[model samples]
Each structure stands twice: as structure tokens, then as C-alpha cells.
Target chain A: MDIAIIFDNIGIYLEGLQTTAWLVSLSLLLGLVLAIPLAVLRTAKSYAVQAPIRAYIYFFRGTPLLVQMFIVYYGFGQFEVIKTSFVWPLFREAWFCALFTFTLNTGAYTTEILRGAIEATPHGEIEAAKAAGMSRLLMLRRIVLPSAFRRALPQYSNEIIFMLHGSSLASVITLVDITGAARIINSRFYSPYEAFLTAAVFYMTLTFMIVFLVKQLEKRWFAHLQPQKTS
Target chain B: MINLHGYGPSILEGTFLTIAVSLAALALSMLLGILGALGKLSGSLSLRLAAQTYTTIIRGIPDLVLMLLVFFGGQVFINQVAPLLGYEDYIDINPFIAGVSTIGFIFGAYMTETFRGAILAVPRGQIEAAYAYGMRRDQMFRRILMPQMIRHAIPGFGNNWLVLVKTTALVSIIGLDDMVRKASLAAGATRLPFTFYLVVAFNYLVITSISVYLLRWLETRYSAGVIRA
Candidate 1:
């Protein structure tokens, strides 16, 4: 129908795309940084070490991201202590609230994913590390974590995509991400097809890009598992 | 102890509606999944390609954009068609229906993959054996394929169900009075958004935890005779 409207509003969509890219990448980067140590703790032998980490993961994984975002965006302002705190201004901004929530949310999911990968490590590898008399920290750094990261790559790609999609919720809180841009265009022009469909195309392109990148990573990462090619 | 400020019952009602919406969407998704799976597995080229496109596009788009599209775009599309059919009044698509259909349609793609794999997992020899015994297609499917497919499908189906339940929260954006919306309403009135949203989160945790437990039991029940590594 009104396809020209989308072309005319290309600048707005570019801004929205930048916002989305920043939100997703920052949250994903921060989430991975948060997940690594927490996942290590999660696979620990002691129940005491695992309990709090379990609860954090459970809460984040169980609840919807939208609710979590709302809790941070709208919920935090309800507390006087937060209002008086040094980071109160960050909490007041919609962007920070979204980023904060996405990081914690993705962090929980990533921690679980990494924990599974770590636990699924071959038994003999750990035994070999112990036989070589390597310290726990050394063994983990040199062996367990690297393999786990590789094993976690496929699942982590899925998490990254989910985070990208989840970032669309930032639109709900008045941030002009792709969905927000589409919403603005739709409301202004009453052209939902032109607006939201364009948004969908952007999302689809990003999803395929992630999928392609992950495939390339897997081929490189899992080369050892592949059979040798005949010359 | 947390104070609800007498909005506990309202939240409970919202929880029930959330459950209702999820179940409705689940039923719709399963139906579409079965059909899509059958289409994917069908002999016709058009059917296979159609199924492939459906799942691919749905997987690529975010649920919220699709929800907004179907809710807002569906309204526009309906009125545009209605005029040609001699309808004079504007027809507003119900948010509940729009939300449910959009979610169902989206998850159907996922279910298509799950069900197709589950169906493929059913040993081909068993189906051939049934055919050799002079069993009809429907009978063979009901007696052999269904049981094994269910067993194989439980794990994936459970994961999809959990995600679907949580996705129902998006209905609030379209003005459905689900628990999230109810919590926000209560928060607005009392100016204690933290308490209300925390309660909503707790509610979701309860639902998902219970579902997880039940799904585990279902998996065990379905896997009763099967040996595992």
C-alpha cells in the first residue's frame, strides 16, 4: 500500500536500528561477563555455593522479560532509597532500565546454558587435569572454561537472538527501537503494514545474520569433531 | 511480609485470565503445528514449501511486532474487506483473539519443527509393519505413531509451552487485563510498582515451576517402557 511512507521515514528507522543494535550488543556483552563466574559457581560441589545462583537463574528464567523490565523501569522508582541513591539518575532513564533488566535476564539464561555445557564436559578431561596436579583455578581457566565456551556457542547464539527479539520490548517503555519506530510510523500514518512489516524485515535480516555468523563459528569451532577429508 | 493493599483478588483474576489465554493459544498452536508438520512431511512440493516459509518467517520476527501487526493490521485489513462484503460498520478485532491467534500462529512454527522431528523419530519399520498387517492409515497413526510421537514430543512441547505461557504477558501491551496489566494497574493506584511487579513475577515463577514439575511427570509417564542411556 503506502510503501513510500517507510522509505520517507528511513532516517527514523536507522536511529531505531542503532538503538536496537546498542541495546542488544551491550546487554549480551554484559550478560556474558556476568554469566561466566556465576556459571562456574553453579557447577560447584557445595550446595551453599549453588543456592543463591540457582535462585537468581530460576527467578529470571521463570518470569517474563517484560515483567522484569517493568519491575526495573517502573518498579524501582517506587522506592525512596533508590531515588536518593547515587545511581538514581540511571534508574530514572528508560534506556538504563531496559539495559539493566536485559543484562540480568540474559545473564541468568546464559549462566544456565554455560552451566549445562560445563557439566557436560568429558569426565576424563577433569581427571587428566587433576592427574597433572594442576590447581582448580588453572584447570578451569586452561581447560573447562574454553571447551564450555565452544560447546555453549550454538546455544549462546540462540540466546543472542532471543535477546535481540526481547529488546523489542524496550519500545513499550517509550524507547525508539525498531518496534518503537514502527509504532511511531503506524500511529502517525495509520499504515501498520508499511510500518510493522518494515520492522519485521529488519528483525528477520538480523536473525539470519546471527544464524549465518553462528554457523561459521561452529564450523571453525567444531573442526576437531569433523572427519578428515580425502585429498 | 508484603502488602497487596487489597488488590490480591484482582491479581488472582488476572492470573486466571492469563491461564485461560495461554491454554487457548496452546490449543490453537498445537492444531497449527500438527497441520504444518503434516504439510512439511507431505508429498506435494507446494505444501512443503508453504510449511517451510511459515516456520522461517515466524522464527525471524519478534512476537511483539507480530502481535502489534495482527492486532492493528488485522483491524485495518478486516474493515477494508468488510466494505466489499456490504458491511457498513467498523469491526474492531478483539485483543484477546488477536493476541491468542498471533501467539498461536508464531508458536505453531516452533511446534511444526518439534512435531516433524517427533514424527520422524517414530521408527519407520513399525509403520511398515502396521501396513503389512493390513492396517489403514488412520488406524496405524492412532495406534502406533501417536504414542511414540507423544513420547518424543514431550520435552520440546514442554519447553514450547513454558515459553508460550510467558509470551502471554505480551497481551498486556495490547490492553488485555492479564496479571501483568493488573499488577501495573494496582501499582499505578498505590504508587508501589515495585511490590506489584514483584508479585506478578512471583506469580509467573509459580506457574512455570508447576508446569515444569508436571512436564517432568508427563515425560516419565511417556517414557515408561523406553530405556535411556
Candidate 2:
């Protein structure tokens, strides 16, 4: 019940909060960027074109992100080839390890989510665009990607929330995220309830905020799906 | 080539423990899921509110935070209560129990949603027919609803199961000596994190593959007559 420790060490918790925010957002942004083209390939009719991305998704989704993080962070360091390479320094930092793994993991989920959305697009819309003289790239840019993204928004928000929670795993690698701050507090004061509960409060607040923002975005972007008003 | 430097058996033992915890947690969550779903679907306002609060809070918090909080904080909470009950010694929360309960509680919230959806997916006419036959609630549930709900729930339940298996890795964080912890121990001794984690990853892949195969078969078996567009 001694809440003063949390208040006194508020700055450390804030630093952790900042790190978690950065981790989730950066990975989500990178994942979204990569998911677009990968999802396009995913919906292709050809197996050869789609197989590799499917394998990538299957591997990432099948395993735990903790193990994946270890494979990248600890696995890469075990190799002298990687250690002597240009990206060795990056592999050596916990933050980079977290970023690399989080990006790949989120990319896999987003690719799948967006692929489902893209595949659900009506065939007539594409045919209509084709008949109107829209080229493949132009039609994808104008009609397909936008609608798929909008349709994917709800699922994507869930994935985003998952990433936010997943970022807590960064603390395992000694990156000072929110969970790291809580661990620090717990060790210093032996008050797990106060330390961890404070971090939980921060997480719950963020989750609700993200949910609210996504709801607003969905209303704005999905208004076209709403019924026409009788004036 | 498997070179664990004499730690393979430990990893195997860890794998068994992983299965143990996953099964235990799965059972606990299913019970909680059914109860929570029933609560949410019931007519009582308090029941619905309680179920909703449980799902919302569990879904919002990180699983790792909850694990730490329950394992460590549960200890403190128990000690605080023990003095009033005339208990003199500190009670340690078993990591297995802690891991299972925490994962079960977290996934219960998720399973509640899936079970609720499945319950709702049961055809209305069938229920009305059962009611007209003067069947009791329990009888109607067993004879009319359970089979159909299971069929409808398989897809979502399959998904939840896969995620649940993967999430068991977190139990290692709380000192459960699960596969991940065993791999890390082996890696620490041999300084070959690559090999151990690769094995762990392969182990997980095998489990997921088997789960996928079995779930697909179950889906096909249950959906014998249902037509798909």
C-alpha cells in the first residue's frame, strides 16, 4: 500500500512508457508498410508467388515471439559471421533486437490480416475498375488497397494492441520498457503489487485509449458503409 | 545434428512440463469460458456486468504483467491475509499452479467471447422446438445445443488453442522450467543460443502442426453436412 515509491520513481516509469510507445509504434508502422505488398502477393492466384510469404507467416505465427526474439538476439550473436558483419552492433543492442523481432512478428500477423481483407474484396469492383481503363497498379492503388485497409482496420487494431502487449517482452532482453521499470521497482522495494500494478494501470489506460481512437477512426473511414439518412 | 552438451533430457522434461501446464490451463479456461459465457448470456444485469468487467480487464492488461503480479503479488496478498487467519508461515505459490492459473485466467476472457459467439450461433428454431417439446434447460443444452456449439466453436477454439500453446513460453519467465527456460539454461552452459532456441522453435512447430492437423480433421468431421459457399 506504500504508493509513494511509484510517485517518487515516476520518471523511470515514464522513460519505460516512452520506450514501450516507441517499440509498438515503430514495429506497427514497419509492419504495415511491409504488409501491403506481401498481402498483395498473398492474394495472388499462383502458388509459387504466394508460397514463400505463406511459409513466412506460418513460421512466425507458429512459434512464440519470445523464442523468436531469442533466435534473433541470442542466435545471431552466436554466429561469428554476423558478429564480424556491419549489422553486428545493431544485433548487440537489446533495443535493436526487440525492434527487429517485433517488426517481423507484427509484419507476419498484419500480412495475414490484410490478406484476408484483400481477398474479401468484391470481384465486380476490380472488374469495374478494369473496364473503366484503370491499369493494374492504378486500380490497386485507387480501389483495392484503400478498401482493404479500411476493412482491415478493426482486425489491425487488435493486432496493434497485441503489439503493445508484445512490446513488454522487450523487458526480457533488458530493454527498459514499462515491464522493465516495474521489475526495477519490485527489486528495489520488494513490492510487486505496487510496482507491477502501476505498470498494469499504464497498460490498461493505453489499451483503452487505442480502442477509443480506433473506434473513432472506424466511424470516420467506414461511413460509406452506413445507411443513407432520410432527410 | 543435436548438440545440447548433455541437456537434451532436460529439454524433453521441459517439453513435457510445457504440455502439462498448457493442458491444465486449457481445462481451467474452458470451464471459466463456459461459465463466463453463460453469465453474459443470462438475463441478470449483475451477471452480465461482472462477466463484462472480467473480460475487459483481462484483455486490456499484458499477460507478462499479470504473471508477475499474480506470482509475486499473490504471495504478498496471501501473507497479508494469513495473519488474520492465525497462519504463521509464508506460503509459496507453486509456479506451475501460478502459471496455469494466470494463463487460464487470461485466456478465459478470450474463450468467453468465442463460447458466447458459438452459443449465439446455435439456430433459434432448434431452441424453440426444444422448448415446445417441454425439455428442461439442461436437457435442451445437452441434446440440442452442445453439438452445434462445438461445431461452430471449433475454428475459434482452434485459434485460441494455438495462441495458448505459444503463450505457455511465458511461464518460463516465472521459473517454471518450461522448454524456453531449459533452452536458455542449455544455451548458457554451452554458449550456443542458436542451437537450443532452434530446437525449441522446432518443438513448437511440431506441436502447432499437429494441432492444425487435428483441428482440421475435427472441423471436417463436425461439419459433415453443413454446406459452405
TM-score, per-candidate, Cα-based: 0.98, 0.97
lDDT at A155, model 1: 91
Q: How does model 2 fare in lDDT?
A: 0.94
Q: In model 1, what lDDT does residue B131 have?
A: 97
Model 1 C-alpha lDDT per residue in residues B147-166, reported as the tens digit of each score: 99999999999999999999
List of clashing residue pairs for candidate 1: none
- lDDT by residue (tens digit), candidate 2, B67-167: 99999999888999998999999889899999999999999999999999999999999999999999999999999999999998999999999999999
Candidate 1 regions exceeding 4 Å error are A227-231
Residue B14, candidate 2: C-alpha displacement in angstroms: 1.1
Error of 1 at A41 (Å): 0.6
